[model samples]
Target: MFLFIGLVLFGADRLLLLLESRGHVNWRRTGRRDLSAEPTARLDSLLEDPDRRPVRRP
Candidate 1:
């Protein structure tokens, strides 16, 4: 009936949103690169150098 049809549509919409949030694709593929290594090096350098100070913005 109408109630069943409404529930089906709602469920479908929720499922689509869940998949999209998890980066699931229906057609195209997409992703981001890992910058973990670069950040670790920069952080180590900053921690080692106690004399250096952060630059102030104008």
Candidate 2:
């Protein structure tokens, strides 16, 4: 049972990879995701900034 499940998962992975190669799906990311480069929320921006005044919006 475990072997069958493993085979199915392996087959599915290969099929997805094939689809990704054909550009039918984005199964894998080409570039490494940079969390630091992502846009920060209002609260996070406020915490990171030196000024925490309500009047100031950056």
Candidate 3:
């Protein structure tokens, strides 16, 4: 009984993928943008000490 249920579920998943490939339906295209490449403020600087600047190596 469990085997037949599992097979049916797997087949349904594959059928959805096939339909999605033909542009009949979109299953994963949500309007989401990756902001990691954008310039972000120095959030770490707030935790650091201004007087603790590292010495330059000569």
Candidate 4:
């Protein structure tokens, strides 16, 4: 029982590592995400009036 549990835990860890390598999971503690424009860009895009249509001045 103990060996099975150990193997399962190790397998899970390796799976997480594999997923991290493929960019499917961000589990590292040292990397900084590219959030430089997230806040401002999110606010700008979200606060715009969705019901209004844009006008193009030709």
The lDDT values for all models are 0.69, 0.80, 0.77, 0.78
Expressed as tens digits, the lDDT of each residue in 1-58 for candidate 1 is 9999999989987787778678784422334546674545566875776457776779
Model number with the top TM-score: 4
Q: How close is every model to the real structure, measured as TM-score?
A: 0.42, 0.49, 0.45, 0.50
Choose the strongest candidate by lDDT. 2
RMSD of each: 7.5, 7.1, 12.1, 5.4
Model 1 TM-score relative to the real fold: 0.42
**lDDT of candidate 4 at residue 38, scale 0 to 100:** 66
Give the higher-TM-score candidate: 2 or 4. 4
Q: For model 3, where is the 10-residue window of minimal lDDT?
A: 25-34
List of clashing residue pairs for candidate 3: none
Q: Please provide, for model 2 over 1-58, each residue's C-alpha lDDT reduced to its tens digit, 9 standing for 90 to 100.
A: 9999999999999999899888788776445558899987888765776555557558
Error of 2 at 35 (Å): 13
Which pairs clash in model 4? none
Query: Mind giving the per-residue lDDT tens digits that candidate 3 earns over 1-58?
Result: 9999999999988887788788777555433447887777787876787569886879
Model 3 ranges with Cα > 4 A deviation: 28-58
Q: Regarding TM-score, does 2 or 3 come out ahead? A: 2
